[model samples]
Target: MNCDLNIYCDESTHLPNDNQPFMVLGAIVCPVNKTSEANSRLRELRIKHGLPAYFEIKWNKISPAKVDFYLDVVDYFFDDDDLEFRTVVAGKEFLDHDHFDQTHDDWYYKMMFLLIRNVVPSPGQAFIYLDKKDTRGGEKVRKLHEVIANSIYDFDRRSIRRLQIVESHHVALLQLSDLLLGGVNYANRGLNSSSAKRRVLNRMQERAGITLTKSTLLSETKFNIFCWQPRGNRP
Candidate 1:
């Protein structure tokens, strides 16, 4: 396993009773080799777009002109020819309307499974950065990691090997990435119910020309959202 491959995971939500899809979990995995370049590009983008360094931009704050600028930044940085990003969206239905359930856990686990399966990283180090959640701290993450390890063990059919799940609150780069993804989520939300929007799904198929499998309920659920793989690295 090589010491590379950092997976940045984040979720987006529209909030209560809006009838619009509110939550999305996106993972942007890049090779360690490109981290520096990505960061540099992000810094340049921040300057070019005049967005605050640590602040998150919401739809209401962005006018049409600013939206154009923001999209340009996405095209500039995310359109890179050397990196790949995998996004997972968990809509309100997946979570049972914000309440946790076995079904929800199954959906969450399946999403994680799909994300990792898509990456298919070789025997190398993998870093998973999850956005803070209620069960994200202390025993919860630990248990979640345990569940992931067990799942990996079953998937690999061998003893669990290498993987790291870390909780981070102060990583500015990740925060910026989260904001960028949020913007994408926001822009993509179209005529779907206010509780959930299918824009991202539509955009991904439209832009990337990648069709998701319908056999899987998750894929079907995400059909309305856009999902993309970053340009360069595998998995």
Candidate 2:
């Protein structure tokens, strides 16, 4: 990717039929200059935990045995000055596909745009990677990519260029995004059953000094969040 910034995107509880109260779209923004360093460091952190080079990280995999390792990863995210996390979460309470004049599929990309729009610097190139989770496969992924580029008026392909659906297992940074999104989703959804999960949530809360369930300052670069209201639907 001929870009200066790499964004690893992921979402939690974002299915159309899921009973979850919220759908969160999150991205881990890393500077291109540090992309290799970030991935190398994350893989090294995995090795420190005895995880193999091919190990894939995910939120559902959080367990008591590996809680400490997960905690360290969370800390590493904040400790690393080059990494940033941001998300756009939407409440499903007033979700009306018809009212929004779009299908859930369309809304998914719209949320993706919202998640990245505020962070992508103008007059620069960036590559966006989303977890390969779309139901309609490659075509949908391609369309979302074009939609993002078009939204930014990058019709000439000079600014934001690449958008691809990648398997999270192969991309360590993508997995990090997933873990971060999962933590926020768990807390905001009031899931208190998993102690390991709660511990991560507590750590995140301590780091931000705010409810993991609420939005942080818009200028908060380290851990930023935006809560999308029910009536707020894109054109």
Against the correct fold, how does model 1 do in TM-score? Answer: 0.61
Cα error, candidate 2, residue 148 (Å): 1.8
- Model 2 C-alpha lDDT per residue in residues 40-88, reported as the tens digit of each score: 8888877999988656778888899888888888888889988999988
User: lDDT tens digits, residues 86-190, model 1?
Assistant: 555444533342343345455555555555554534666566666665544555455445666666563552332434344334553455446445545654454
Clashing pairs in 2: none
How many residue pairs clash (N, CA or C atoms closer than 3 angstroms) in each of the candidate models, in the order given? Answer: 24, 0
Per-residue lDDT value at 17 in model 2: 84
Best-fitting candidate, measured by TM-score? 2
Model 2 Cα displacement at 147 (Å)?
Answer: 2.2
